[model samples]
Target: MHSMRLKDKIVVITGASSGIGAITAQMLSKRGAIPILIARSEDKLKETASGIQGRFGMYTCDVRDSARVEETFAEILHAYGRIDILLNNAGYGKFADFTEMPSEEFQDMMDVNYMGIVRCTKAVVPHMLERGSGQIVNVASMAGKIGSSRAVAYTASKHAVLGFTNALRQELRKSGVVISAVNPGPIATDFFKIADPTGTYVKNVAKMMMTPEHVSEQIIKTMEKSKEEMDLPGLAAFGIRLYGLFPRLADKLTYNVMNKK
Candidate 1:
């Protein structure tokens, strides 16, 4: 078979417990990349690492802890001598109508979702620049492109991610570092289970959601090509494009049909 092998290449993945991060480790492993899974929950990280036994490693640290993130990353770099890919996937969500939400909740979202990416990218970029080659994939959401009610903080963080990817890709264009963002519509994960146990969003929107594996497959393909942007489930990207070009009509249509309100 053709090798998408990341053999000898090291990939540092944050938020690597369950969901996208978990699946990505396996996929990268299958492709030959040495996986470095990072998450705050050692138990879960170990569980994931155990299942993916190979040339994989695990680190338990909260991505929001900038100093720890940088320190642990340094440790990894010194240990491995090089890091070839960085996936910024550590994130948390606190969803509610913006006006009804506590300020701390929004702050927390920004800290974990946006700052986590910032810290990790900063820690890795120097090595990537020095090597003059690397890839950075930011795990954003479809909410990154579209403003959604009851998810103001999440939306803002993701939008910032898209912007960060765009700017960094430009700044690093001549440096041989590839930066991109993956906008996943809705991947089946415990995220929704934790965020809306009552099925607040999914109870109404599950019909359109795709599995985590689906998005993960797209991520693999995107990374293989070093693509700048990836919109998973294909349809979601189409929807985003169509609505962007026809806002007024799209709004009325979504509100009437999709919202069922």
Candidate 2:
């Protein structure tokens, strides 16, 4: 095992009931970090914490509710004194063509995916600034950098997250506060159940899907040492850079080849 740099760190994870959030909470606890798990389901939060071997906390919070988010963080800060790190991992996506997607669904994605991070980050920044140290990790998506068909809303929401994270990072450059974004390609999580109800997308890219545990490890790495961004599966990261260099060609490929998956 590597040195436990996260030992004793207080980590707050949102959308922590399942998927990458739940797994990362477990990994953080194993590293001796005190993970404060947040989700909309109190029962689910308890279930997630039940697997931990060490100290941890759970809060039932729907990040989509700004007032609830503020209250939750205040309660957490009061109990823990300070938050060493915040993992904004609570987000969901629904795959659909832009024209077919419901307006409410798009609003929900933006509320949870983009504004949720905004609410949580705002709640922690003042305290972290006062202490002169902290880390904020936003769980973005590969779609944020490279858009694809049938996921217009999700892609837009994630793009907003990356934009917010980048601007915040520059603003807090010398504030002893670290802001980073983690972008991962399709992961084998329940996300597909919602994002791809037809089962077509998952089936098409089953072999390429990464595991939640693998994604959690990358998040842990960010917590231990901050980086501007961490893109999983080195090959995918390369593809993103290549896309940037030649967007016209990339668009053709993204539409013709990648969108099918």
Candidate 3:
């Protein structure tokens, strides 16, 4: 299949206030795409919009709210005419023992990480299906592929994201719309502030953490390439595949690595 050009395409990004989403909006604007930034923080969203090079729009949205998402997308369609891409990147993480994690905290992760994608995707899909062309990129994580010691809730939520992406891809096989999942391990962003408040994870993986710019570039490339899935940092991708092939040995290796930290 021919690669899709991003130039002049209308791209809607969730969590556009900062990190990957914000960087992506800037990059996409530079590449000639109109980026519609969405997040809960109106001021931060505007800050992101202010940095973009071309015409762009910012909408303050909490993805967990289905009604608001619907209304936001309606406004987007009215302004832009059509959405060529949807990047679902609104999510957070809180690492804690499964038993110690509060029920509300766990639900919050599910709401934003998993259902946020569901709500946004549902809102935009019909338009894509009717038009018969579009791209949906879900920014998942390496945690989605391999379970870690201290992130039960976060891991489970990402796992669900992967499942949703895969299932949606299959269902849209004949449709022109493309579905992709990006799994990047430990990105250097404000996400760590909440995910690892003590900075233990950040400290442990400081050298390993990929920058938001790097991940955003990969995501944009994936949209053009129409890849079904991608893993950032080739070595981590290999490790994830290895874990799938040899679970017992991989488990032992993981345990040793965690123990060292």
Candidate 4:
């Protein structure tokens, strides 16, 4: 297999402690990239960094803290010299009906899923601009493209993420900076087992889920090539495109045929 070796490249990944971020950190490090794992849990971050085969480090910061984010970015540059990539993967999902969902939960999702990238991107872009090159990959989801009943806030936040990536990519077009989005379908990770452990939320899609390693591979590929947008698992990508073209038809198919419980 051809290695997309990011040798000597410094990549920062938020939410690097687990799920796609964790797997991506390990995969990139194996391929010669220096990954900086960012998450609130210092212990988990330490574990992830220690297990990496290449140079890996951790930053414990809540992405909601703008001042802390700025400080941390400076610390990274001081240590690594330059940051070549950023994977804003820190996020959470709260599945609940629109009217029944708590207001604070909605705000929290917006803060982390939406504002998290905003704060981190704001911190890293300037340095990239000065260096004349960098890449920011926002981890969005299929929820960004379609409406799911129980994930109103999460869906809205992801849609915002996709929109943000498009707009920012345009603004940075001439700056040698590339900003993109990646939407992944269900993946087998501790997240699902935790958030939807009762299997109430995940039981239905377990059969269709991809492994963390598989999703990580896709993420690294997109990052290496500077892909504008990527949809992991070609099948889901095509399905989403078809759904985009025919919303009502897709909804009917999904609701009636699939029973996407």
Worst 10 residues of 2 by lDDT: 252-261
- Which model scores highest in lDDT? 2
In the range 1-261, model 2's lDDT, one tens digit per residue, is: 865899999999999999999999999988999999999999888889889999998999988888998999999999999999999999999988889999999998999999999999999999999999999999999999988888899999999999999999999999999999999999999998988988999988888899999999999998887877999877888889889899988888777556963
Cα-based lDDT for every prediction = 0.84, 0.92, 0.91, 0.86
lDDT tens readout by residue for model 1, 1-261: 535656767999999999989998998888878999999999999888876856987888898888898899989998899999898988977666678889988888988999889999999999999999999999998888766667788889899888988999999999999998899876679888756667767767778778888887787777788898998768777888888899777767666334321
Q: List the residue pairs that clash in candidate 4.
A: none
Q: Model 3, 1-261: lDDT tens per residue?
A: 223388899999999999999999999988888999999999898888889979998899999899999999999999989999999999999888888899999899999999999999999999999999999999999889888877888989999999999999999989999999999988899998888889887888787879899999899988888888999887877888889899889988887554222
Error of 1 at 162 (Å): 0.8
Model 3 lDDT vs. the true structure?
0.91
Candidate 4 runs further than 4 Å off: 256-261
Give candidate 1 misplaced runs (Cα > 4 Å). Answer: 256-261
Q: Total clashing residue pairs per candidate?
A: 0, 0, 0, 0
Off by over 4 Å in 2: none
lDDT of 4 by residue, 102-219 (tens): 9998898999999999999999998899999999999998888877777788889999999999899998899999988999877788866544656765777767788888988889
Per-model RMSD to reference: 1.7, 1.0, 2.2, 1.6
